[model samples]
Target: MYTKKNYTIKRMLSWTRRYIFMFILLSTIPVVLYEVLDWKWLHLPWLPIGLVGTALAFIIGFKNNASYGRLWEARKIYGGIVNASRLLATMVNDFITNEYALKDRTDAEFFEIKKSMIMRHVAWMTALRHTLRVKKPWETTTNNKSDQEVMKKLHIQEYAFTLEEELKDYLSKEEKQAVLSKTNKQTAVLNLQSKAIKELKLDGLIDDFRHVEFKNMIGELFTLQGKAERIKNFPYPRQFATLNLFFAWIFVALLPFGLMSEFEKIGETLNGSNHTGILFQFISENFVWLTIPFSVVISWIFFTMERIGDVSENPFEGIANDVPITTISRGIEIDIREMIGDDKNEIPKPHPEYEHTQM
Candidate 1:
């Protein structure tokens, strides 16, 4: 996700520059008509516009809260995955031993077993993150032209490589084929893990108690996977999202109309005064043009708030503002591999951040 304390105003403007231009154009129309064309009847009352603004603000606030809730929930689910993965690595390192084995093996053999299990778990994480990064019909962050431009600067690891390519490093040829063949690659990888654990139990490398514990941990991983899937599959209520957009645009369209009259009234009041200097009179008489900037700023605020909610609604769309699943998964892989004492060179390094953002 965006790791910086805040986005620079320049960057924000760059991302929304097209819309800002539209707002400027929208604001300038009524001022030109009322001032140059002398169409005084074109201006709207401020009271009704104020009421619409209030209603739009409430809806935007509500949508932001709900969108943040989904993002936070996705983060919590990945946090659980990180903990469970570490626990599984610790269990593999400590529980499987010669003390309980039906047939004793060499130190190299035991190490191989531990390494295989750990690597398989990493493969499962890779499969899961790849699944989450797949596009859903409702996800729009990457579809926007502005968002697409910003994404070019951020390196999203999941999109950089295919699932099969990454899995090759962690899975055997037969296992990788099995995983890729399945419709649900993550579920297939997990099933392979369970089978391997079961075989270890039968060989007495893992005792009965440890076997059950391993099964329980796998179940927890499944639960976490399902939780992430739920958020990925379901979207924030579209009806609310649709209406929120419509309302925000309606308020923006009406804003300048109301503002033109308010500024004109101030200009009229100054024109009637005799005490004001020439400079003050000049400024006051043209004050209605100030409506353009005021309207642009006000419209930009409402539209930006609406855009924030829209982008945040899906946390797994592989955008800069997502939950950083690729980074999290890579971290888990590194931590678990180190725990099992795999070759330092063989263990992959953490995914690097790009433009102060981790994917």
Candidate 2:
């Protein structure tokens, strides 16, 4: 979702700065105690810490892979929707005809029918996207404070307006009211579409073969909708996610304890052998303290990787990093309406970009 060629160091620091501070504070404690207070017992061996680091790496790797899988799957589902939408629009424009109509109708009337069906398809997309963006209890984008702070700097599509207001543009007054009354608004919209298509068939505007084809397209849309909903509703296993955080912090906490001693040993080795100059002696004596920054930097990497996986797991939560479903839906609307010869001004423009990423 971050489309820039590369995130600047300043941008990466902005995201991880808070944790960096925490890591520095954590790492500094043992250094001060060992050097100033002569608390020699405050050090840990590298072997145990090394083992923990290896295990944590494997755990974090699994989590990132799983999270990426969910994100990619959501994108693929929406890609399918994009293809199916264009197909549905083309069929709506070409498949229905006056050739077999039960009653005589003018060209303008047939155009109106095509327009209504296309508008209803737009309504279906709107309803589906709105439903997908609803906040679930498990969604971190809305639930976590740090993530909420990040979201404050960006725009989300569903946050811009109420569903009722947007639906009015695509559905007739009665149809909008009917949809509003339903618990599952997207499903209701699709049902209305099916009913309308059946009516067109009964009136002989669309022949039997075309009616069956339309129904099949409708089924594919439903399939795509269900696939997106499944990822949105079912989350990655929480035990792994929860424990991975704990394990990463455990490694971070012990990292500096082990690192301080190793760095001090290097400093001691440098001081024990004679140095060539005062400057070299000064550097040797002071090298032990370098562990603070080194520890913070190392710990920040592990924490940042874990946080990335945590945030990337859910792709439709209306965050900037999501699948951009709202933008994709609006694009479909533009294409469908334009195929029916609607004015450019009448078709909505694409959703605006936020921080170089479209929602």
Candidate 3:
């Protein structure tokens, strides 16, 4: 996500420049035609255009609100994962003991068990993030060409390594193969985690209460996983998205036509005998053409807002505005491994930022 407090003007311009260029071209067409050809019929009344703009504003507002809700919800879900992961690591360290075991186990064996479970949890995170980053046909980040180019420059997280490569560090060869073979790798990882904990309970390494607590923690992970999957699999309703674009464009198209007449009136008033300065009079006389830039600016606002909503609606898409799942996953891996007493060198560093955004 954009970790910086505010987007720099340079960065904002980089994103919006293409849209601004398109708007300028779109607005210039009618103004050039009207001024050169004297096509008085090209202009539309400002009142009706203002009403359309008002309605379009409301529609865009609704879409942006919905998009923000999705983005914030995804962040909260991952935040829960962060907290639960720490709790899970702490519980694993504390709960497993020889006091409850049917057979006497050494401290080394207990350490190994804690290590295994923690590594498995890391594998689960790897699987979950990889699943979320899988490209959906509807996701703008993957579907848009220019967006893909920008993402390449920023070096998105999922692209840094294949899921299998990352999982190899956390899972045994057989377990990795089993997970890769599954249709839903994340769910499989969680199931393996549950079975492992149950085996611990059966062997009396952990008490019954601890076993239940372990299962409950796994269940919470399941819920969080389901929440993330829901956002990834389900897209915003296409009807609303499609129509919002259409209406916004409609307003943009009619905007210059309406503004041209108002500008021409100003031009006429200035061209009359009331104007004394030649420079001011000439500028005002040519003000009708100024509608192009004015319209371009206004239309740019609407188009950029719509585009922002489109990109924000899918928070797991590995775009600049996405939830930074890869960073979060790596952070959890570091935290959990450290909590379980893994060597400092064995723990991977947290994902770093590029262009002020953590991917």
RMSD in angstroms, all models? 2.5, 2.4, 2.6
Give the residue spans of candidate 2 off by over 4 A.
1-7, 355-359
lDDT of 1 by residue, 1-359 (tens): 55444455567778788889999999999899999999999988899999999999999999999999999999999999999999999999999898888899898999999998888988999999889988887887546888777777778777898998998888999999999999999899999999999999999898889999999998999999999999999999999999998998899899999999999999899888885698898888899999999999999999888888888899998777788888888889889889988899987788776443322
**Cα lDDT tens digits for candidate 2, 1-359:** 56454465556677777888899899999899988998978999999999999999999999999998999999999899889989988998898888899997887887889889889988988888888888888888766767777778877667888889999888999999999999989999999999999999999989989999999999998999899899989998999999999999999999989998899899889999956789889888878799899999889989988988887898888666678888888888898889888878778888775553422
* Model 3, TM vs. native: 0.95
- Ordered by lDDT, highest first, the candidates read 1, 3, 2
lDDT of each: 0.89, 0.87, 0.88
| Candidate scoring better on lDDT of 1 and 2 | 1
Q: What is the Cα-based lDDT of residue 129 in candidate 3?
A: 88
Q: Which stretches of candidate 3 lie over 4 Å from their true place?
A: 1-7, 355-359
Q: How high a TM-score does candidate 2 get?
A: 0.95
Candidate 1 vs candidate 3: the lDDT winner is: 1
